[model samples]
Every structure is written in C-alpha cells, then in structure tokens.
Target: MSLFILWGAVFFTLALVFYSVGIWNDYCHKQLKKWHITMFGLGVLTDTLGTLLMYLHVGYLIFTAHSISGFLGLFLMMSHFCWAFLAIRNNDLQLLNNFHRFSILVWSFWMISYISGLYLGINGLG
Candidate 1:
C-alpha cells in the first residue's frame, strides 16, 4: 500500500478502536465518565484526520456515493459528539441519556462508511 493509504488505515483503525470502546463503555457501563468523553473525542479526532488523509490521497474528488456517505457519517459523528459534550457541560445527564439513541444510528452509518472504504481500498489493490 502507498504511504497515504497506510497512514489513513492506521488512523481509521484508531478511530474505530476509540469509537467502539467509547460506545461500549457508555452503553454497558452506563456511566458518563470523563474517560467516555475522552474516548469519543479521540474517535472523532482520529476519524477526521483519517478522512483528511484519504481525501488528500484521492486528490479531493468527492462526488462518489461513498464520499457522500462518508461526509454524512462524519457529520453525524461530529454532531453526536458535540451534543454529548454540550449535554455533559450543561450538567444534563438526563438529556445525554436520551440523546444516546442517536449514537447507535451514527455508529451504524459510520461502520457502513468504514466497510465501503475498505472495499474500495481492497478493490484498488486488486
């Protein structure tokens, strides 16, 4: 793989790790801990970086269906993270609890984007 794909893959893997851990912790542990916030934040940050690297590698042509889904997924994740952060900052755990329903939706879409990107990468290799 090229360096661009390699680095993008690494960052995207980190993003998945962070997101999975955060979402699992939040759902299973049922806590609004700082670590949860940190994990989710890291997920978003890494995802953004990974996307940026991929975008650069792709020469900024983003008119494909996968690109649209990727953009939507990223936006959803960002919105979810921002909502959670604000809810926590405002001391509204109740609101946060209610808002978690959106988490699953965003995560599902994120996974779709990830899988599609992987398919694209492997197809490129082939």
Candidate 2:
C-alpha cells in the first residue's frame, strides 16, 4: 500500500479507538446526554470502513463517504463540546438550542475541504 493508504488506515483505527472510548464513557457514566456519543460510534464505524477500503486501494467510495462522514461526526462533536461548555456557563439548555448554528458553519467549511481533498486524491491529482 502507498503511504497515504497506510496513513489513512492508521488514522481510521485511531478514530475507532477514540469512539470506542466514548462508548465506554457513555456506558459507565450513565447520566450525560447521548446523541453526540452515539454520533462518535457511527462516525468511527464509517471512517474505519473508509480507511480499510483505502488500504485496498478502492477509489471514490471510501474517500467520498469518509469525507462526508468525518465532517458530520465532527459537527456533532463540536456541538456537544459547545453544549457542555454552555451548560457549565449558564446551567441551561438554551445555548444548546442554537448550537447548530456554529456547527453548521464549521461543518460546511470542513465538508468543502474534504470534498476537494477526495476529488484530488481520487483523480490522481493529490
């Protein structure tokens, strides 16, 4: 495998481990909100598949899917982070109601970058 594929695989594996940690945390903690934690697992699963496909040198499918998924996962994660912080600050859920506003903006930019990267990589332009 090329370096990129190997690196991608490694990265994906790392993400899987991280998400697994989140799952364990959720299971053990029992009281935290769960949407973002679930998102982590789903994200890790998708990304792991994507990275494995990359290792196999499959083009486009893994690249595009991973690109979209990574952005979505991170978007949820960012919202979770913001929510946690805001909850600490205001002791309320009001800020979380609007958390998506910032997450959308960040996700949009990240998606664009991921799409561009996938296009270049899949087209042999990377």
Candidate 3:
C-alpha cells in the first residue's frame, strides 16, 4: 500500500474509535458531556482527512458509490454533532436528548461508509 493509503487507514481507524466512543457515551451513559462532543468532532475531522487522502491518491476516479455515501455519512455526523453541541451550549437538555435519539442512525451511516470503504480499499476497487 502507498503512504496515503496507510495514513488514511490510521486516521479512519481513529475516526471509528472516536465515533464509537461518542455513541457509547450517548447511549449507554445517557449523559452528554464535553468529551462526547469532542469525540464526535474528532471523529468527523479524522474521517474527513482520511477521505481526502484517498481522494488525493486516486483523484476524480475515486468518486465511487462508496465515496459518495461516505461523504454523506460524514455530513450527517457533523450535523448531528453540531446539533448536540449547540443544544448543550444553549442549556437545552431536552433538545440534546432528542438529538441523542439520532445517534443510532448516525452510527449506522458511519459504519456503512466504513465497511464500504474497507471493502473498496481491500479489493483495490477505489
């Protein structure tokens, strides 16, 4: 694998871990915290960086179905993160909990992108 692929793998792995932490914190802990917000932000940022690296490596030809879905997933995750962050900042716990319900869908989309990307990368399809 090339350096870009290797680094992408590393950052995406971190993204997965961070996202998992955020989801777990939200669902299991049932409490919103600064660390949870940080984790979500970090996950999105890392995932974006990793995706950018892959895009750079393959140029426009890398715009596969998986990549498109991955970008959409990243967008939703970021939006959800921002929603939760703002809700917390505005002292709206009810809104925060309401947004927490969206975490499952966020996690699902993220994992779909992750699995699709993994498949593409492993099969040299990207």
Candidate 4:
C-alpha cells in the first residue's frame, strides 16, 4: 500500500511535469524543446529506477543501496515537481497557480516524510 502510494505519487508527478511543460510551451513561444523533455524524462525514469531498487532490498547491504537510491529518487522527484511549478510560475501560466502551489507543498511534505521513514527503517528503527 505504501509502495502504491509512492508509485502513484511518482506517476502523478510525471503527469504534472508533462502537462505543465506542454502548456507552457504552447502558450509561451513554444520554448520547451527536446532537450528539456529528454532531461525531464531521464530524471523521472531515474527516480522510478531508484524506487524499484529500494523495493528489491531484503538485507543490510542491499538495503543500504536501496535507502540511498530511494532518497536520491525522492530528491529527483522533488526536482521534477519544483521544475514543473517553476516553469508554470515563470510563464504566469495560471491554469491553476493556487492549486499547483498547494500540490507542490503537499508533495514536498510527503517526500520528506517518506524519506524520514526510510531512514529510520534502514537504521533498524522502523
């Protein structure tokens, strides 16, 4: 269930990134080019990869790598959210500025909580 939540968040974040960038490009001089798109894809893909890596661990050594990758993925996920919001905010692309801001905050909070929990779990405290 928690894994579902994490993956769900990742998918939602990816969708938001695509939508935000598409909207921005269409509305603001068609600026979101191939490079940005490719980078964004790689970032999200790496994030998902890291999550999967975390999911594969069952012991200390693997768990450590998993923990590190999980945190890295969360960081990348955060970057994606921030980038999407910033692009929209920069262009004043207010499809839902208030909503986006609220969403970003929620995502950030969740990421922090998730990472903290993973930290404790890795340290045998969970």
Best by TM-score: 3
lDDT of each: 0.82, 0.53, 0.85, 0.49
lDDT of 3 by residue, 74-118 (tens): 899889889878887997977876666788788888899899888
- lDDT per residue for candidate 4 within 9-34, as digits (tens), equals 46534544653454344335544444
lDDT rank, highest first? 3, 1, 2, 4
lDDT string for model 2 (1-126, tens) is 486565764665555455445544544554335554455545445555555556456544444554565656555555555554555457566655544454444444544545565566677664
Candidate 3: C-alpha RMSD to true structure equals 1.4
lDDT of 3: 0.85
- RMSD each, Å: 1.7, 9.2, 1.4, 10.9
Clashing pairs in 2: none
If both were scored by TM-score, which would come out higher, candidate 2 or candidate 4? 2
Clashing pairs in 4: none
lDDT of 4 at 15: 41
1 or 2: which has the higher lDDT? 1
What's each prediction's TM-score?
Answer: 0.90, 0.41, 0.92, 0.34
| Candidate 4 lowest-lDDT run of ten | 57-66
lDDT at residue 49 of model 4 (Cα atoms): 56
Which ten residues in a row are the worst by lDDT in model 2? 23-32
State the lDDT of candidate 1 residue by residue for 1-126, as single tens digits: 667778988998899999978877787766666677788899999999988888788776667878788889889888878877888789886777766566777888999988988998889831
